[model samples]
Target: MSAPIQLRPDETFLLNVGPQHPATHGVLRVKMQMDGEYIVKAETVLGYVHRMHEKMGENRTYAQYLPNLSRLDYLGALGYTHGHVLAIERAAGIEVPERAEYIRAITVELNRVASHLFWFGAFVMDLGGFSPLMYAIQDREHILDMLEAVTGARLTYCYYRFGGLYNDVDDDFIEAAKRFIPRMRKSLKKYDALVSGNIIFQKRLEGIAPVSAEMCRKYGATGPVARGSGINFDVRKNEPYSVYPEFDFDVPVYHECDSLARYKVRMDEMEQSLRIIEQGLEKLPDGPIMVEKKPKTIKLPVGDYYQAVETARGSFGIRIVSDGDKNAYRLKLRSPTYSNMHLFDEACEGMLIMDALAFMGSLDLVIPEIDR
Candidate 1:
């Protein structure tokens, strides 16, 4: 009798990436299915740093909850705080004073610039470049200094009030932002040379993680991710809340739809934010920084309101359901990164492990934002 033919079964491997890995940029664990070095499937396991922020928000009063927003995206604390305060004001129909709106606009733009700068640095570092991170952080420190003088804190700034800001911007803060603008413009040129034009960066990201416009819409991606895919849907442009209508700036878009395209979009956004800051400084009007008629306590009518603001990461939505009480009955935060990370499942398939990390980094997942 002829011997039976033997065949080898295909091998599947399990890979655990993170909770301590640098590519994660935060505490994220990705369990990947691999056929050799290429990933066949990827699953992201979050909640390593869950703080139960939404549940906590329901228990705290509107003013008391402002401090918690910053903890979501600590790198862009002002943006989170701005969105939360705007939500409360919108829910209660509070009229923020003109000077207060301008100040909020200026400071939020500055915070956006700072946030993008950090992303620029970290994105490059993820691709095996390190020097840009240091340079970017050095420039970002200037914005931090200006923010600290006004907000009294560096990272988690609880500066926004219900009807206005906690305080008005002093001349010193305005002068510092003005001085920082031109210097920042010049520094962009240096960053362009340092990372943007580098052949290595281009090769690593050129065609990796391509997401079509249709896919972005299906998944509700925002900020640079949607823009990179040629979806011109920035909340700042579409919704135009909080003095954004008064400013003239373009929402940067890229048709490339790859990691490289996402990188360029964010780099361009920093320049556009700088322009907004400059215009805000010139057009800022003098008026009361806070509404004189604001009640000592806040009680919204019994209804639900959804407020969305363009954060450095993407669109941050705050939904509050009030039972005519000082504290919200229910509060929900729709974090951008949580939705954006959903794309990683599709984007990382069939890519190498390193390429998957690059794709993940490009998504800019702030673990806290997702877990919040």
Candidate 2:
């Protein structure tokens, strides 16, 4: 999916990075206008993995389109499905069970932690540190195993239903979750000592690619990218979806606005996610996972319905225009990666290629989600 490099007048020469590079993490190609290792300008070229998920949403019924949510961001598929289901549920005026909401919150937070773990490993690997990736993955595997047992898929989960989840959790799932808390806490300490405290790692990221609050506002950036700039806005705290308002958790923010600042934000967020999961698990009520009242068919009234959820990457929103039918008249998926990636062109300008890559890795992009 690599594209041929194009020349620009401002550059001495062009360097094509990725569309196949491991540092890119996916099929992302950056056309860099470079002058002797310094990047004068940069442009991100996407569409390599565009699946047209929005088009698919128009063709399929609400129920039939449920599985496609996973294809957007496989690492945080449950969040996408959660947004889609909530959008439809609101449009149809359906009430979700309390226990089901708790389970949804628990699973989503677990998935968010898994995503941050994966990002931590890959980001370190980008900076030429490989050993930490192994440690990160080792901890991430436990989360994957726990999620797989309930969702029936390790990644790209479609376990959520319109009214509730497709299934319920057992004592084993709860026990595994409780066990992971302390174990992951120990791993976080190790990661801090091993990677976060490393002199070379700190030097590479500390002051590199500092994005200002104004830049984030211009690009409509959210999640850690915005929080790193001290914006102090989280969809969970700002919008309060699902049962997030009931739990006690902190939204991590850093005013430094550099790659290290962004890194710290995600690192702190993983711990907060653990706190949320622990709270949800302790207060998990005993009740039916699914609502008893059922509509014979899923249909949305003619109106514009939008629901947003805070995914691992950022705010993921599903907007639907219904015509009083089972299928959507129009569908729009507002993905966080798209907004986050928008800041890259300006952010990467005038930086060295290596630092630019570090900044890119800090964004934690899932290209398919942006392309979709």
Candidate 3:
């Protein structure tokens, strides 16, 4: 009889990728099960920086809670502020002024562009590119300048009031945006040439982390993540609110369901956003920036209401349960990143650690947004 064939035992190792790792973008700990460099399993352990913003909001009055919105997604403060104010206005049955709505829309779209620009730079940087970050920042600075002129703050602007905006966009702000839009479009072409066609970037991202449309819906993915998987479910399109119904723009979708698909979706979204901004500028009407009947204190009708807005990362929903009081009985925030991150557990299985970082970066997570 031949000697028994020697068998090699399967080996497994454990690795902790972050809490401080550069790839995480924020404080996130990913427990990884690895067979060599390939990750067989990955479990993201959050709550590292959780602030419980919802609880804080519930305890504060509507006017007092306005600042908390900026804390949720500091990177996209305007979008967060807009979501909260819009929800409160809807719940209280308040009528926001027409000019105020236009200003809110413009600021939110500009913030969306800034958020996407940062994501574009960071995503490429995670994949081993650097120059795009600098180029993207150059455009983002123009947005910052415009926001600062009206909001008086750069990163965390608390400019959205319950029934309208805190201030108006002056002629200078409009002119700056008009000048910046053409420059941004030109810069986008440069970005397309820089990383979109680079052989190295394509090799790393083209077919990696493919998530099907069914999986995306099941996992509650939104924004570019869902759009990347051929799911056309944008809040702006599906449930139009504010002045989005007046804007002419396409919801960019990709059937590829891979990293490249996500990249393309964001690129296309930037262009669509620019179109929205241009339309908003042209049709912008002149009126009072604040409601004529501004309330001294906000008190909503006793009921529950939800308002959702399309942020740069995904769709953000603010649910307010009012008890006919100045303070909300319950304030629940359904953050897009919270649901989007759920896909990571399934998507990261069997992918290399490096690829996993690329995949996570593609999701464009904001830790506070998830934790809140």
CA lDDT scores, all candidates in order: 0.90, 0.92, 0.89
Writing each residue's lDDT as its tens digit, candidate 2 over 50-127 gives 998999999999998999998999787888888898888888988999999999999999999999999999999999
Model 3 misplaced stretches (Cα beyond 4 Å) = 1-10
TM-score of each: 0.96, 0.97, 0.97
Q: What would the TM-score be for candidate 3 when compared with the true structure? A: 0.97
Model 1 accuracy (lDDT, Cα) = 0.90
Ranking by lDDT: 2, 1, 3
Model 1 TM-score is: 0.96
How displaced is residue 156 in candidate 3, in Å? Answer: 0.7
Q: For model 2, how big is the CA root-mean-square deviation?
A: 3.8
RMSD (CA, angstroms), candidate 3: 3.8
Candidate 2 regions with alpha-carbon error over 4 angstroms: 1-11
Candidate 1 lDDT over residue span 1-372, tens digit each: 022323222676889998888889889899998877778788989999999999998898887898899999988888888888888888788999988999999999999999998988888899999999999999999999999999999999999988988878899999999999999999999999988889999889998888898888888999999999998989998998999999999999999999999999999999999999999999999999988997699999999988899999899999999999989999999999998998988878777888888888898888988998
Candidate 3: Cα lDDT at 52: 79
Better candidate by lDDT, 1 or 3: 1
